[model samples]
Target: MYRKMVLIRRFEEMAGKQYMQASIGGFCHLYIGQEAVAVGIISALRPDDYVMGTYREHGQILAVGSDPKAIMAELFGRETGISRGKGGSMHLFDRERNFMGGDGIVGGGLPIATGVGLAIRYRGGDQVCVCFFGDGAVNEGAFHEALNMAALWKLPVIFVCENNLYGMGTQVTRASAVPDLNRRVSGYGMESAHVDGMDLLAIRALSDDVVAECRAGRGPWFIEAKTYRYRGHSMADPATYRTKDEVEEWRVRDPISIYEKQLLGAGLITDEEIRGISAEIDAVVDESVKFAEESPFPQADALYDHVYASGE
Candidate 1:
């Protein structure tokens, strides 16, 4: 779990660098401080479980065990990308891994997640679908609709709201009539809870129970993970709306650092081992960049290939 968090942190850091260097084009959303939310929730899931996410989903895909090289290539618009470079950062998809792709639209994945749950029920499969979105998405009509449908049918879906307190520079208090997002689940008569997103172990323990319940035919749970993003909403965002002091306050409780301290305190891992892990992940991130840099762009002729279902 620690290693996964580090990998995502390092990967996002490098991705930010690549975006600034003009190597990675299109809208890039980095999941920096919110590593625990992805790692904790995903690490508890089975390999076959479906995982869906929002545009800021590099961390989620990584937690689902997609190759860093392919993801980096996608960001660079290379032909070897996970989505063949067409989806870029926002639309990463890995069917083999059951990562149902990231959506560019706010609350887009909610309805799809509901549909996935319905499919699971239809097929009589015990598989569960975990859909992740931001605090902003809760306001979308789709959010309410999807939750209502999932609850009505008792679908095996876990709706995870990664509440980072800002919907593109607007604070949650300013935007939401009721700032407590978990409470909104009451309207749909769905079970809900809150987790400290900075604490990975806590999130993982809660996820284990929730996922089991969902798989056991009691489902459509809502989890509001109280997380914070260290970076802006996207590469283009300056994030000047918030003061530096507020950012620093959250930084003091950084998910990675919090977990590192716990591990150290428990004597579960040594400082040397942590250093070794960091070095290894750093090399992996570096290699992903090299792969992206050396890879060729998608050819023009292949553009129309995946666009249509029929080979018209």
Candidate 2:
């Protein structure tokens, strides 16, 4: 878990650097501070279970076992990318891995995740679908509609709201009528939990138990993970809406640092082991960047390849 978080941290750092260097195009949202939420939730998911997330999803894709090389390649707009470079940063799909995609539209993934849950029920399978979205999406009508349907049908879907306190530059209090997002879920008669997204262990334990319950056909559970982002909504904005002191306060509870300290105190890991993991992640991230750099961009003639037919 430490290694995975470190890898994602370093990956985002490198991606941000590359974006600043003008090597990568398009909007890029970093998952720097919210690594624990993605890793912990994904760790609880089964291989056959589905995972869906919002635009801030590089870590989510990686957590669900998408190759770093492929993800980086996609960001680089290279043909060998997970979506053949067309999906860019927001959309990453791997059918074999059961990762639906990281939706670019706010609250877009909710209905799709509910559909996946419906499919599992229709097939008489126990597979669960985990929908990850930001607090911003809670205001979107789709979030409420999807939850209502998921609850009414008892579809196996776990809705995870990663509440980072802001939607782009707008604060949650300024946007949401009910800042307590879990309460919104309760209106639909869905079970919900408010959680510490920074604490990986807490998320893992709760998600594990909830996932088990959902897989057993008792679900459409909701979890509001109170977390924060270390960076702005995108690389473009300076994040002037929040203060340095606020950022520093959250930094003290940096997921990786908190977990590392816990691991050390519990005798679960030595300092040297932690350092070794960091070194290994650095190498992997380096290789991933190189792989993306060496890869080719999509061909011009391939634009119409994956286009859907009219089905007439």
Candidate 3:
């Protein structure tokens, strides 16, 4: 869990740097402070389970076992990218891995995840579909509609909401009428709970239980992960809405640092081991950047190729 969390943190740090350097185009949302949410949830998932997420999905993709080199190449719009350079930061897909996509639309992934859950049941498979979205998305009609249908059908799906205090610029208190986002699926008659997103061990344990329940033909569940993002909603947003002190407060509970402290306190990892792991992750990130740099950008004619549907 510590290694997985660290890798995501370092990967996003490098991604942000690259975006500032003009290597990555399009809207880039850095999942800096919410490392544990992605690491914990994804690491607990089975290999064949389906996953879908919102625009802020880079970490989710990385944590789910996607190749860093290909992911970086996709961010760079290179032909060697996972989506063949067509989808940038907000859109990534890998059917082989069952990572459906990172939808750019706010609440778009909810219904799609429900459909995936339905499909799995239709095929008589026990695989669970995990849909990750932000606090802001739960208020959308699609979210309510999807959950209602999923609950009615008893679909094997889990709705994980990463509540990072604010939705873009508006705080949850100002945006949501309910405020307690854990109740998102309550009206739909689905089981739900709130979890400390910063605690990796707790998140992993709960996620494991959720997966098990869903795989056993139980109804859908919803999770309200109390997480926060250090960066703005997008690379463009300056995040002037929140105060400096508020940001610092959340920084102190940073998932990576908190997890590191736990590892140290438990005598599970030496200080030297932590440094070694950091160095290893840095090297991997450096290699990914190099791979993206050496890769070719898609040609203009290549655009026309994937544009039309081939009648199978």
Candidate 4:
């Protein structure tokens, strides 16, 4: 778990650097502080369980076991990318890992997740679909619609809201009529709960119980993970809306640091071991960048490919 979080942190840091260096084109959304939310929830799931995420999804994809090299290549617009360089940062997909993909539009993954749940039910499969989105998405009509249908059919889906206080520059309090997002689940008659996203263990424990229940047919649960993003919404934004003091306050409860403290307190790991893990992850991130740098770009002739399904 610690290694996974470190991998995401390191990967995002390198990705941000690449984006600024113009090696990675398009909008790049770094998943810096909200590592625990993705690591915790995805780690507790079965390998076959489906996972969907929003545009800010590098961490989510990584947590589901996607290759770091392929993800980095995708961000670099290389042919060896997971999406063959077409999807870029916001549209990462790994079908073989049951990582459906990341959607660019806010709340776009909601309805798709509902459909996945419906498919699972129709196929009489026990697999659950964990769909992740931000706080801003809850206000979208698609959110209500998707949840309503999922609740109605009792779909095996866990809708996780990564409530990171701000949806871009706008604060949740200003945008949401009810700041307590889990309470909004009352309308759909779905089960809901809140968890501290910085506490990876707590999130993992909650995920295990909820995923089991959902797979057992008492499903379509909602989880509001109270998390904070240390960086701006995207590479373009300066995040001038929030004060430096507020950011520092959240940093004190940094997910990686909090988890490290817990592990040390429990005598589960040593400082030396932590340093070793960090070194290993650093090497991995460095290699991913190298792989992306060496990989080829997609050819112009291939543009029409994968555009439509073949009749044969």
Model 3 stretches with alpha carbons more than 4 Å out: 309-312
For model 3, residues 1-312, the per-residue Cα lDDT tens digits are 787778888889999999999999989999999989988988888889999977998899988888889999999999999898999888988878899889998889999999999999999998999999998897899988999999999999999999998889999999888998655467789999789998998999999999899999995999989999999999999999999999999999989898899899999999999999999989999999999999999998886776658822
lDDT of every model, 2 decimals? 0.95, 0.92, 0.90, 0.95
Can you rank all candidates by lDDT, best first?
A: 4, 1, 2, 3
Worst 10 residues of 1 by lDDT: 175-184
- lDDT of prediction 3: 0.90
Predicted candidate 2: what Cα RMSD to the true structure?
Answer: 1.3
- TM-score per model over all chains: 0.99, 0.98, 0.97, 0.99
Per TM-score, what order, best first? 1, 4, 2, 3
What TM-score does candidate 1 reach? Answer: 0.99
For model 3 the TM-score comes to 0.97
lDDT of 4 by residue, 1-312 (tens): 999999999999999999999999889999999999999999999999999989999999999989999999999999999999989999999999999888999999999999999999999999999999999999999999999999999999999999999999999999989888777798899999999999999999999999999999999999999999999999999999999999999999999999999999999999999999999999999999999999999999768788767822
